[model samples]
Target chain A: MSAFTRFTPLIQSLPSTIPFVGPEAIERQRGRAIAARIGANESGFGPAESVVQAMREAATGTWKYADPENHDLKQALATRLGVSAANIAIGEGIDGLLGQIVRLVIEPGMPVVTSFGAYPTFNYHVVGHGGRLVTVPYVGDREDLDGLLAAVKKENAPLVYFANPDNPMGSWWPAERIVEFAKALPETTLFILDEAYCETAPAEALPAIDAFIDMPNVVRTRTFSKAYGLAGSRVGYVVTTPGTAQAFDKIRNHFGMNRIGVAAAVAALADRDYLATVTARIAHSRERIAEIAQSNGLSPLVSATNFVAIDCGRDAVYARAIVDTLMSDHGIFIRMPGVAPLNRCIRVSTGPQAEMDLLEAALPNVLAKLAGGQ
Target chain B: MSAFTRFTPLIQSLPSTIPFVGPEAIERQRGRAIAARIGANESGFGPAESVVQAMREAATGTWKYADPENHDLKQALATRLGVSAANIAIGEGIDGLLGQIVRLVIEPGMPVVTSFGAYPTFNYHVVGHGGRLVTVPYVGDREDLDGLLAAVKKENAPLVYFANPDNPMGSWWPAERIVEFAKALPETTLFILDEAYCETAPAEALPAIDAFIDMPNVVRTRTFSKAYGLAGSRVGYVVTTPGTAQAFDKIRNHFGMNRIGVAAAVAALADRDYLATVTARIAHSRERIAEIAQSNGLSPLVSATNFVAIDCGRDAVYARAIVDTLMSDHGIFIRMPGVAPLNRCIRVSTGPQAEMDLLEAALPNVLAKLAGGQ
Candidate 1:
């Protein structure tokens, strides 16, 4: 148990904890394989066939380091988004970019604001940089934009995070409200407008790419993980002002990108037809999930994301029992939000029909077992 | 030219710069294609067939995130190295791991010790974390171990970096000397014994894996990017005490690993015969490069790495001219060290026969042109 004793005080004060325990860890810990792999919001539909082919082709060149400037991918993204390549910055994923953003802005003891039960990974980064957390509560299972702005102004926080088509709860605010919130924030406050679930959301739920393209204080993060269905590829980017995007070059691991992953993302972007088809399939799957939840007498919240949150009409204890029992007894894996009120709901990601079929059959029996005190 | 107004003072003070200009950027800037890529120490020999096949196979699972715990890869590495899984931590690459290591121990103004002309990426990380650098000059081309020890003791520095079979100069000390240096350091000073080229080094040049396994202050970093010929795979690991290894889990992006890249590393490790073949090829290429340099009236240093550093019999100006003319006139891409003494040499990475043939044909012509004052 001997450790190097000279770690920075901030790093020493932090716990060695994962923001979310991945499903693989659960399988290992429980000695059971996940039958319905819908806990994480990864698209079970997978990436386009062309993307797989592109990755396979790129594999032959695996000995070459990826372009440190990320030229090709940035060019592709810019062409598609109606922006210049200088306005885009790529990273390992949105998670990695979030860490970089925190480092770029937060000094020790600086205040960062986010929803109480928002993405834990963001909170993890904020704390890693010795930033003080100033959390607002989720209002109506959606991130409270006005509350977040109020907290930011009160603390004079340098950073604020708000995810559209949010995770865990799968709720979202319309584009107009989000744009209003962005414009209302103080110019000094940097806003991370995460659009990780935008591809699966209603058109009205996402602002236009040009909505804040000139706004230096706003950075919108997008990912290839959800609708593009390449979660394992680890490609994500930030859409911000050119100068803001360039700031990342100061500290990012210049050659850290995986070559095949970049190729996968580029291929995924090129296949617009595939994206349209997959988003439709995702929508269909979400409907199926909602139907199953309703049939089991659970109230499924309206979600714009790739998942649905079903209210169990009980406390966190009951929700915890359902999550654990489903995983342990039936090999089903689903997750719930981490805090009060939100934890009253269990989140299930949309997946292919086979996984949906498994969830359909297991939920009623799990409810019965719980009702009968197991 | 707009950016967020309230970035940290440290971030504001730092310039946006990349440590190394990638060949791709050079190609873009020069408006030419590189006919021979022997720069950046990337293995143009490429990865093994088995590794490529594994990556192609893993491409289908690109929709699922890599296991955050990295269980399979960790198990494979531990089994190969005869250490427990807890004694290792994986990252995007050695570059990424160096950044994490810097963040772990360094606060603003903390002194960090390294060679004067060592890896620029390591220096970038230290500077990015606001650590004050204390550099010891190289002795004869090899890193000066005693001088580094002196600096660490003089500054009471918490961190020191020394790479074996060093980059740019490609020089190394005997394993016994390295171990002696490690033992001589104050226990309070963390030693980063970077064994990036160990696979290609002579048996006497590398200490046994268990040499510093019990030492809490020593962390040895190894990469598949070198001998395994998988630079684009972005898989590197740290061999350290279990406690120190666990510290990475505190700040690392848990799910940052690319699925196909990890698959390639696992496959690369499993195929020991291919590793042997590639390392042999690398060694052969190095000899061919040395011959080319000698025939061109240059002094090629004995190299343990995949690259040879050839003394141009002049100053940095001559080395810089040779590098620039090789690329601009012959489309041959190579690099030189960044500082004095080391900058008298131009570094060439070992590659396949084709690239060596290009270098063989071009170096004399470029030298002739330089002699003619072109």
Candidate 2:
């Protein structure tokens, strides 16, 4: 139980708690293999064959460290997004970038703002840097933008986070409203506009790529993890003003990138047809998930992302029971929101038909078992 | 030029600088492709075929996020090292882990100790955290372990870094001396024993795997990047007491690991025969490099690493000329130590015979051109 006695006071004060328990941990704990891995919202549709080919080819070159500047990847991303490579900063994932962003803006006791029950990992980074979080409750199962702005102003917080096509709730605000929210924020407040789910989100749900290009206060994060189906590859980037992008260089591990992962990401960006096909498949799968929820007398929330959050028409306990029973009884893995109101819904990721089939067959029995108090 | 104006004073004050200019950047700057990629200390001998196959297999599963706990990889490393899974923490690489370690121990203005010519990435992390560096100079081309201990004691530095079978110099201290050094450090001073080159070192050069397991203040860093030829995979781990090991979870990006990279590491570990073969090849390549240096009228230091540091028998200017001419005139990319004394030597990574041949054929001419002052 011994530990180094001289860790910083902020580090000492923090708990060694993880933001989320992964599906793999759940498998180990339950002593059962998951039949449907829909919980984490990863695309079971998978990446393009071309991307797989690229990753396989890149494997032979694994002896060399990846380019520290990530020049090629940046050029590819910049070209695709219609932004300059100078405006982009790449990291292991959006999660990693979030940690860096938090470190850049926050010092001990600094106030930060985010929606209650939004991304817990963001909260983890905030607290890790000794930043005090001022959370605004989600309204209508969507992140409360106005509330977040109000809290930021009242607390004079330096940082705020908002995820579009948000997790757990499968809800979103329109692009115009989001743009309005960014414009309304004080220039001193750094806004983290997380667009991890933008690939699958409706076109109207996302702002033009350049909408915040001139706003130094805005940092939009995008990732290859969702519709691109490279979650395990762990490639993500930030789009910000050139100066803000350069700030990351001051703190980032220059050679931290995985070569094969970067190759997969580059290849993923090139295969536009695959992206279109995957998004269509993801949309279809979402429909299937919604149908399964409705057949079991549940209401599925409207979704722009690659997942459906079904309202169980009950409390957190009921939703938790369903989530647990679905995994325990049928080896179907799905998640639920961590906080109330949203916790009444069990979130299901869009996957191929096989996972939807497992969900379709398991939900009724799970609900019936819960109703019968067993 | 716009940036978020509210960055913490420490971050704002720091200039954006990278620790090393990657060879890829050199290619871009010079507008030429490198023929010999023996810089950055990466293995051009490449990872085992088994590892490549494993990475290819894992590529399809890129749709799923890597396990946040990294349970399987930890179990594999623990079983191989005869340690418990709780005793290890995995990171993107030693560089990423160094950043985390610095964050854990250093606050603004705190002193941090390391050899002056040691890993620049470690120094980069300290500076990024606003830690004041208290550097001990290398004595006789080896890290000044005694000097490091004295500095740490004098400054009451909470963190100290020492790389055995060191980078940039390719020098090492034997097992007993390293153990003695560890035992002499104050309990409050966290010692980072970087063994990034251990796989290529002689057996007597490494302390027993369990030698410092009970010492909470000691965290031994290791990587798959060296002899395993998986530098681009970005997998590294720290072996330490369970309490200290768990501390990484408090601030790390939980899903930060690349799934394919982890698979490659596990496969690399399982293929013990390949590791032995690659290490032998690395040793042979190092010998070949030494012979080449000797033939070119330069003195190569005795090495226990995948690279050899060759003394150019002059100042840093001459050494710089040799490195630059090799790259510019002959497409031979190599590097040198960043600081004086060590900077008198040019560092060359061990690679395939083709690269060695390229170096052998090019070195004399590059030296001749430098001697001619053109």
List each model's interface RMSD: 0.7, 0.7
* Weakest ten-residue segment in model 1 chain B by summed lDDT: B5-14
What's the residue-level lDDT of B362 in candidate 1? 93
Candidate 2 lDDT over B205-308, as tens digits, reads 99999899999999999999989899999999999999999989888888999999999999999999999899999999999999999999999999999999
Ten contiguous residues with the weakest lDDT in model 2 chain B: B365-374
**Model 2: pairs clashing at backbone N, Cα or C within 3 Å:** none
Cand. 2 TM to true fold:
0.99
Stretches of model 1 off by over 4 angstroms after superposition: none
- Provide TM-scores for the models: 0.99, 0.99
What residue pairs are clashing in model 1? none
lDDT of each: 0.93, 0.93
Best by DockQ: 2
